[model samples]
Target: MPKVLDCLVNVHFGEREQPAWMLEVRDKYFKGPQSMYRQVDLAELIDEMDEQGVEKAILMYSIVKPSPTALKFVEEMPDRFALAVNGVDLLHPVSSLRELAALVHDLPVAYTTVGPSFWGDGMYPPTDAVYYPLYYKCAELGLPLCMNTGLPGPPIPGEVQNPIHLDRVCYRFPELKLCMIHGADPWWDVAIRLLIKYENLRLMTSAWSPKRLPDSLLHYMRTRGRDKVIFGSDWPVLPMRRLVPEALALDLPDDVRDNYLYRNAQEFFFGGRSAGGTAE
Candidate 1:
């Protein structure tokens, strides 16, 4: 297997399990077994990662703040894990920015996230001034901002997540490294156009299975988007054991596959280190 670095993983390390509401949503929409939501011991998770050739993974918390369980995972295996903060309250921009700053200040935070549907009841669009402060802070810190850009799995209001909303964001905060996670869905064309228009934006294949990825995105990944895309398992949501092999089996150029698997992520989060090393 080629080197791999999962950009968005929901790790159930320690005593934490995925919240019940989220699991209920997955059970309702997903067609397969709910095995992805099953909790596993940290050591068991590590064994699976090792078995799958995942060099590192960014542990993202699903709620409104960073989870202690994620911190504990990083603390226990600093070389194997990094943190991503999610669900910051855009309603209170100032406090949110401060909390974001504090999280990055005290931890190995790779980036911060905004789940348009999950936060503020899916009312705030990506371009809303409410998200500006967070965007500004991320640009200031040279930190990447990951957002849910497609129709969300949970039945929350999804109009707030249109990929079009990011056009203004990229134009306003040109320096912020923005990553759109989950698939861009119905708006793949718009997402593709915006990615072409913004040097700092990227698309991450996280929750969507590789074979299920839209043809447009696969074409983009194999062609001009080689360096503009990254990989993520959204773990348990799609276990590495299954996700990695499917990704590696894609009919992509070797270089494009390499970039999708790890190289682009290295540049995105680790300043383009050429050697095999963990993401920070």
Candidate 2:
């Protein structure tokens, strides 16, 4: 298998089991889901990555972003990972969003994560005024927006699943590269149409099941023929060992599969940057 760089996995402090929001999410949606995030540590995660041959992973976490986590990985290994930062918590109704923009400047940041599912609690609708400042921060930084567009978490309602709601943000921040995950879930067709229409928008097929690489997703690639799709396996839930092999075994054209597997990510995002830098 080509080296798998899982772009989004979360790791958190084991003792930090009391973040009110997380506890709320656990009570509501994580009814019986394993609490691995609180269980795994760097050594354990690295051993798994080695055993599975996962070359790298970009973390997108709750209390903090992945860039800091990547810094930790690189400090010991110096070349194993990179990250995208998600600044959604800047929504606390102060100059918090703008202040975060300044804080991020000193950090080894990449993109900021947000998704409609995680919007209000999931990806909030792009039309909500609460998100404008965050959008502005994204555009200013030239960092991509890691927008979630997949299965709704239990805490999120059904209405928030549509990816079309992001149209307003796309229109307003044309300069910001929006990386949609899970191919924007059910409204994938709308997402593909948008991708074909705008060069600035991109999507990852990370969580898409091979059995159902939706018609629109396949059609857009076969016809429009762009190499924007990147590999992203929602690791931990779907371990890299399983997800990578399944993706490798898909019935896609060799080139398409390669791009989806590794090329697109190496080109569009990190561009071969060597890892290892702490944010000032």
Candidate 3:
């Protein structure tokens, strides 16, 4: 059996230091009147992964700010944790590129993630010129850039989450590896086309519960697109204990499961290394 690699986990969502706007968004989408948002501590998170047989998890940061605590967590357990940085100020592309270069060079960060929908309707589309420098920097660093697609969890403009915008990006940055987070949901057909069209592009099934995974995505994962789809628990939103087993219980073949669980992500993020180690 292959070890699990959870491609998306958030360690800072419900923390006290998290921004009020984020908490508000969480309350609206993730929490209910009878339920409260619970922040998972580092120890608890590690234990959960251990119990669920997860070999590694990528800890994603908020777009508003990168969490120092997340950096510390990955620093403490470099083998088990990988950081996915956020908050690159696209308005200041030059400085943002420098910061991204430094982060990938100096820290245990595996890559960066962004939600184009968070910037609102008319601003910062994935194809915007503002992201060109960042794409170039990522290609230079040999890091895959992950971005959220499909409907955002919060009540943000869903139009911005369209997978079509990425078409232009893929065309422009052919050398840059891109992971479309959330499997592009309602746009699965377009997402599949993108994956087939662009050798450098892949998809991560994060945020979507296994039971809730779209049939089209399941078909792609089990068949021709096996090597292009990756697994992620989107922790805090969906518990790994539940998500992992649900994914493993799918009708997918063993090899497909192995690739989705770890191998594909391993190659995409870590240069297809046979030896196991955290991203540096």
User: Comparing 2 and 3 by lDDT, which wins?
Assistant: 3
Q: Rate the local accuracy (lDDT) of all candidates.
A: 0.82, 0.63, 0.80
Clashes of 2: 11
Ranking by TM-score: 1, 3, 2
Show where candidate 3 strays beyond 4 Å. 17-28, 31-39, 62-64, 120-122, 274-280
Judged by lDDT relative to the true structure, which candidate is superior, 1 or 3? Answer: 1
- Name the Cα RMSD for model 3: 2.6
Best by lDDT: 1
Estimate candidate 2's alpha-carbon lDDT, on a 0 to 1 scale: 0.63
Could you tell me the lDDT of residue 55 within candidate 2?
A: 70
Instruction: Give model 3's TM-score versus the native structure.
Output: 0.91
What C-alpha lDDT does candidate 1 achieve relative to the native structure? 0.82
